[model samples]
Target: MTQSCVARVTAAYRRIAEADRPEVWITLRPEADVLAEATALDARLAAGEPLPLAGVLVAVKDNIDVAGLPTTAACPAFAYTPEADAPAVRRLLDAGAVVLGKTNLDQFATGLVGTRSPYGPVRNALRPEKISGGSSSGSAVAVALGIADIALGTDTAGSGRVPAALNGIVGIKPTLGLVPTTGVVPAARSYDAVTVFARTLTEAQRAVGVMTGPDDGDPRSRAWPDDVRLAAPSRPRIAVPREEDLAPLSDGGRAAFAAAVKQVEAAGATTAVVDVSPLLLAARLLYDGALVAERYAAVGEFIAGDPSAADPTVAGIILGAAGLPAHALAADQERLDRYRAMARRALSGYDALLLPTTTGHPDIAEVLADPVAVNSRLGTYTNFVNLLDMAAVAVPAGEADGSPFGVSVVTRAFEDQPALDIAALLTGEQAPEPLPGCGVDLAVFGAHLSGQPLNHQLTDSGARYAGEVTTTAAYRLTALGTTPPKPGLVRVGPGGGAPIGGERWTLSPAALGHFIAALPAPMSLGRVELAEGRWVLGFQCDPDSAAGGTDITEHGGWRAYLEAAGEAATG
Candidate 1:
């Protein structure tokens, strides 16, 4: 609004014209109408109206209806001009975002590779020769190329996530049914979700936030649970897929994923390599098992009526499900339920699961020559999400060789905020905000910091890393001569100690009780005042316990003291 909303729209249109990527959009909104809307937006701003999205330009994947625009979903023969916008689109528009147009995608959102669309392939924004991951291909490319601030897409498999990874942007696929899909053409009905794309995690999150709410018209839309944890763990126990699970990863992908693992650890996360075969096994069910019949249920009639009008690859995949026996689908559902339980047990105490978004990025020719295999391989790390009823946020971690590489932070359903926060933490693009009220937050200046000797006690107790914080300048740190060596924290009455750095973690009440019951003499739990003027449960040593201990306050925190001690020992 500051630069004139109309001017922003005009500039975006100019960029789109210069880019000349027709396949990216099946129906570009008339420039005059967009400018008029922007002008109205500017007047609203001038009238002192508050707008959260405020002039944000958006592109909608064609499968999601936009009033006055044809919902082709990249197949012209099935096009329909809707009189009203999809709920997701209307939400963004209501929040002051202006729609650029309806973008192309894999016909009926059936394929991962962008090439399945009859509108023509939506080329990768980075290297035109590379395939833009889809079926949300054009929407992702639009954001990556700076043509739009945000884009709406649909994800049944990896449509939302894969395209964002390939194009180097952020994609947030919320908990299924969290964002209404009422006006969106069904991909797989039960599994499909509306996703938002943006250049940064915050923007994508902001867009998704505005779009989240109940949709009475869409039975899939569910209310976010009132008891869900609001903060991403400041120090989380992350589950990493075993190396074998990544066997299809190219050398460059492996190297990049390794670096991504290190980045998360640096952000205060502790990771354990675990077998994720159950999740992988479940992923195969999407296309390789009876569950794919959902796609058949979605549009089998349209494809059956005129297979010639659909992308043969999409038509073939969806049609294959048409003949699946009803009992077969029922049996697979039972199997999927078992996998879900197994996945939960495997991820029992972890805050999130981190994985490469895809095995690798392929060139357009490679995908064109072998569409199915390439598409399947790309989904190796992505397909099980919706099936498992989880939420995820995909962000760029760095690059693999010369190709852009990214990772997804996957968390249980309704934990969208944490998934997004973890993705933000990895990229160092945004800081996570604390959302208390669900679990007990404990501030630990010593033993329980990630990687510290006694940290396992907290992890074993199901503690989640809340974040790093410092005590108000009224606490002292002391080195206690205990077995395994622990730090003692003591509060000096007033103005007598330094502000001591520490890390915070959240644990269940029962876990906290057990954690305290096992604490040996000299160590105690009490309220500790933070620099932010808030008090949280924390470790505080009895003043007598520190009477004979060596003062380590100058070292700041336990980790720093340990590092200094290690350096001294090495020297």
Candidate 2:
């Protein structure tokens, strides 16, 4: 894998040079410099370094700083060179990913349509005549064009997700502040989130995992919450919009969403219709109400200094918010709190909420003819997300009106894994693992596996199934004579052991403690080694307590052992 970084970087530069899509990039690094970095990464990997993103080529949206590259945010006069990388970029680099260049975006990230850029509109990757959603327009197109393995974008008003939806790629808009936005030009500082775009949901989720953490530079950065679910429930309760709420969808778009809903059901999820009025009302507040004042607060003075330096529509929107009364801002806060509460109640028991990433895919000419109305409509399903402090994963569903149609799976703040899990299910891609260090990963080998009687103990404690695994040959499995038959995994000092099959489960920190505390004697949590990677918290037995237990190692797993004894499925 390390040997391939040079070839991958070479291919990316060639693709960039050959695409003839000048508008997609604002400042590309010299091919030689990028190649040299890739070469260094190859060397590091060969030297026994662990690089999760080794050879992964990344594109940074122009609004986010990439050391040595100018961050234009598609506004030439506002461009500046940063001495260091943004927290997001730094993390990716540390994980062995190399930056390709700075991709274009709407001027100051103010519009949903990609046309607001002074660098020239970023045309859709699939069909040039259509609008590429913004303000992270070029980054999405870059990823779609295969010029980058992972692209970074910012989503304030669906800029990140909308573009990905248009380009038929995976877009990850994490829960607010999950990836610190320090060194990024803020559209709405409090609402802005650095998002990831990749061709596959698995790749997109991996990139997101690399960027998840807290940063001192960003005051809004948050430590991963201990209560968030690391994975979705097996039979998830998915929330869908009321039929009337989808009135904004055109015929093709509506049909595509219906098909997408079918995909969700096929994934073993049960859907429930819910009223989204309060959320929609709050979404309007992003721009139509006092929340727009944050835009003015971000760069209103800069636009004021040289109005001609910014895009007319972007300038107009920012300027309009400049004179709002302070009271309106205060009142809007109270109103938003109420709407959040209502929206929360509406989504109480759901694991994920689904919505079209946008109402429809519009043509560039059509949006150019009527920019504001079309842009607002594009944000119909998206503008409420950040305001309500939620996470959403947007992925291609199918096609609508000859353009790719996509849906956003929304989850409560920090519950991003469930959103990605459902997206993976819809796309038939590999489901993501638990976020590293975010939750406790426990390995179970007995009656607690899926489809077994005692599995509810983990589920009841809010644990989620991470994935299946096989323990190393160093461990042995024994039949523990408990009320509900269980398997005791023991680490034998040497050669007389066999591989054991088990499942890994993720639990919140609080839940793990409670779960372990409730475990019966001889079933304590201990370090159990897997076939690969490091040891994890797993079920183990006191060797002394297992002296009289029947050895079940020859059966390969507890389930297999029980099957031979005609007892595994009895529970």
Candidate 3:
């Protein structure tokens, strides 16, 4: 049954109450006000009104104004109650999305580390000890925790994508000027973009679609081209950083990235190594050079009003920006233009560039010890993106060392679709299922899971990971005698089998046809009932094939079996 907006939102509020992650929000709307908004939307739906985002709840970064909510931007003394919603938030509200309230962020959106917020650092959604990449920390965490369906964050130097990566959610850094920023508190006016965080690229795009177009209130807003086309090239050419550029990554991060690259290649794209030194140099300019002066220019007066009112680190950075002379700022601008041109040329031959979203994940303690240095490392791959005027989406590649690992799909400005397309492939998230859309859910028990060998086949077919599940206790799992050892899930009569673990993925109708047709013998697509009480097309082994395989059902899953094999070999 399709759930109503109120039901979904009520559940979300309940979840938020249970989470008790106070740092994720700066100002939460009264529960009554939130329900009231949802009730209004429900009434509108009853009246036969069409609402694209009916009942959707969204969290806005405190830097972005929402009517009646104080815009703190993580600095209490700088708070103000904006009488109106930001242009971006207003549009979402008009589409039937409700305001959940204001989320915390790095003070003035100044630092990449979430710890810069006076309200307290926004902890990683999945790992309490890790830093939630920021200044959009709280907004991203809110979405990652299901507290909101969508969250608005500003990206000056990867504020949006960095946090999304750390929390295992989707971050869409739209083409600059495509989404108006008039109501948003600017970090670097010219480079600032209102970004979106969601669980899937499809949902993010839906929000972006409603928010796109020029707004008189925002001079920075630009009209999208009439002929703008969203697409995914069947044979995309992907660009990767040279090996030396990957030195900053931890071993797990490197392996996760390598796995992502292989998935794209298996999906039919070819990869090329590119020297991104120039791009890295441009990134350094964002914080290390005179470019930071823009942040000073945006909020310097407020800092001067009362230095103590600002976060010490944020104040320090802005104060330093005050020292950059006009000539140095000019020099940095000139260098930026040169880097943009070079990047344009470097990316011209490829459909998109794939980059590790961050060098490493650091815990709050580590960031607090040496704030600037650690924050700089996090932006090593992201800071150059906006300066180069590109569109990028960060999607979770998989888990690395128990934390989420993500990669960004980047392309020239306005080429946002290709990035989304690649993200969907890598992350296994299908495009938003508009009415009458054609797609199918395909469940897999082994090999096709993220980071697993042969997982690339699903990606190549443009499949998306929908969720995980265990079959009804009517299946037996066994290790096939294949050279690489694959799992075969065979159905047995009720009570004659044990529940087996697996992942469920979605694929477009066209991709599904191709995927099923290419399956080898002993493995075929058939129905499997999930513990959730829904049946989906999933991997089923031929009964005869199970005869020659060793029963390993006690391990519970393919991954578990593999872990046992490795342990036995090492032990």
Candidate 4:
């Protein structure tokens, strides 16, 4: 029997515990409570209720109000029991998503590094020693670790995007006011946005759709034009900053970004080099200019009465904001307005702008040593996003030396759908795999893993696929370099070519047919034997299609081949 979504989420939650929870959460709802929510959702689905999320498990950052949970914003003294769920949280629950619990965050939502929270720093899911980027730290970690399918985080200055980059998940900061922030504790009221974190773009986009719309409760909310609704663009013109503008990125980050740009171009998009200094200047205003005062304005009385209540870093930052002169604040506001206008004009001709989600990932110790400076650096690409009233989605570009690299797609406010659509193009959807007894195991040699070109063919077919898993030795992989890029697989004799590349995925017979029918020319589905003697759907190229292609078998896999090529070019 197929495992239910509730069952999958329960197993995921338990598995997280088995791996040693990362202290990403401040409070977890009792398992019983969660189960109750899940059971109710399953019943609703059985009754044919139109549920958008339908059994999706979601985590809320502690800063956002959830009716039964205390909103701590990672500071105990600042904690308050909200009378009701935040508007965003209410929307998610209404969509059939069950709240897992409240996750930790930067104290008062001040730091980009998750370490500032009194609850303890959130470690990177991929590398325990590294910091989980924040103030959406716990949310990102939770999603990355599969503790939840979707998470709600607030982004003021890169809080949502940075953590997602570090944790290798999708982080979306929708246009300001797109998701109401009425019950969220404000970091910078005008710039604060409820962000989404998910393992895949589909889930993230779905979550956003549920939470969006004009909310009378939030004064900033505005109705989006139906015709201009945010979705993936048919043909995208993406602007990229010149290399000189990205001087702060590490060697690995720069290379990964370049590769990502190439991938986007390969996916049929035109990329233009543009100056982003105006936006960067505006980002500076958030901390260095009058915006700091907004922080002071957000929680002044609470901090003034109990300085000990806030994290030292958060308290210090907020205190510094208090020193800003009123005139300077006015001047900074003027500067922000001017920059916003400049950004609108600059982005008028493009479908979206692409930038590295963060310059580089900093270690936990580095953040502790120079909390403010290091955190500011991580926000280079993200800080200006909300300030400019834009929508952004950060998709994993690829891994660089074991660490993940991500790029953000930005569009004018209310163009969230287009931004998400572009992101889907950049990072194709990888279907969720069925449980062991639910369906047959299949090995995919190409174009179905997250970020691959043709993965959407699998997701749209309702195939349940898991994250990437290496194949057993025995398959021969070839780079056919067909249109839109494709990989071919062929079985060889015993002890033939080593398992060059493959990912274990699954699909129902019906879904498999749908996936096959959607394939473009030059690519077809075939059964290929795995080393383990199992056979499943795999990409096969026409014999003539490999005529002019370079043999890359020695590199073992396309990813390895590309890595080698990049090293050679850079070296």
Alpha-carbon RMSD to native, per candidate: 6.2, 3.0, 12.9, 13.8
Clashes of 3: 4
CA-lDDT, candidates in order: 0.88, 0.89, 0.86, 0.79
In candidate 4, which residue pairs clash?
Answer: 230-417, 230-418, 231-417, 231-418, 232-421, 431-465, 432-464, 432-465, 433-464, 433-465
Model 4, residue 409: C-alpha shift (Å): 0.5
Candidate 3 lDDT at 275 equals 84
Worst 10 residues of 1 by lDDT: 430-439
Q: What is the model-wide C-alpha lDDT for candidate 2?
A: 0.89
Model 4 spans > 4 angstroms off: 226-233, 430-571
In what order do the candidates fall by TM-score, top score first?
2, 1, 3, 4
lDDT of 2 by residue, 186-293 (tens): 999989999999999888888988898999999999988766666777778899998899999989999999999999898799999999878888999999999899
lDDT of 3 by residue, 1-571 (tens): 1678778778888999899899998998888878877787888999999888888789999999898889988888888999998889998999988888899999999888899987899999999999999999999999999888899999988998999898999999988998999888889998999999999887888888788778899887886443232445557889999889999998899999999999989877889999888888899999888999999998998898899989888899998888789999999999999999888787777889999998888999999999989999999999998898888999989978889999999888876766887777787666443211244778999878777887877766545566788988889998898755588999887888888899987666766677678888788999998888889999889989998999988988999999999999999
Pairs in clash, predicted candidate 1: 234-465, 234-466, 235-465
Superposed on all Cα atoms, model 1 deviates from the true structure by an RMSD in Å of 6.2
Q: Rank the candidates by lDDT, best first.
A: 2, 1, 3, 4
Q: What's model 1's TM-score?
A: 0.79
Score every model by TM-score.
0.79, 0.92, 0.76, 0.74
Query: Each model's number of backbone clashes?
Result: 3, 0, 4, 10
Candidate 3: which pairs clash?
267-460, 428-464, 428-465, 429-464
Could you tell me the lDDT of residue 430 within candidate 2? 72
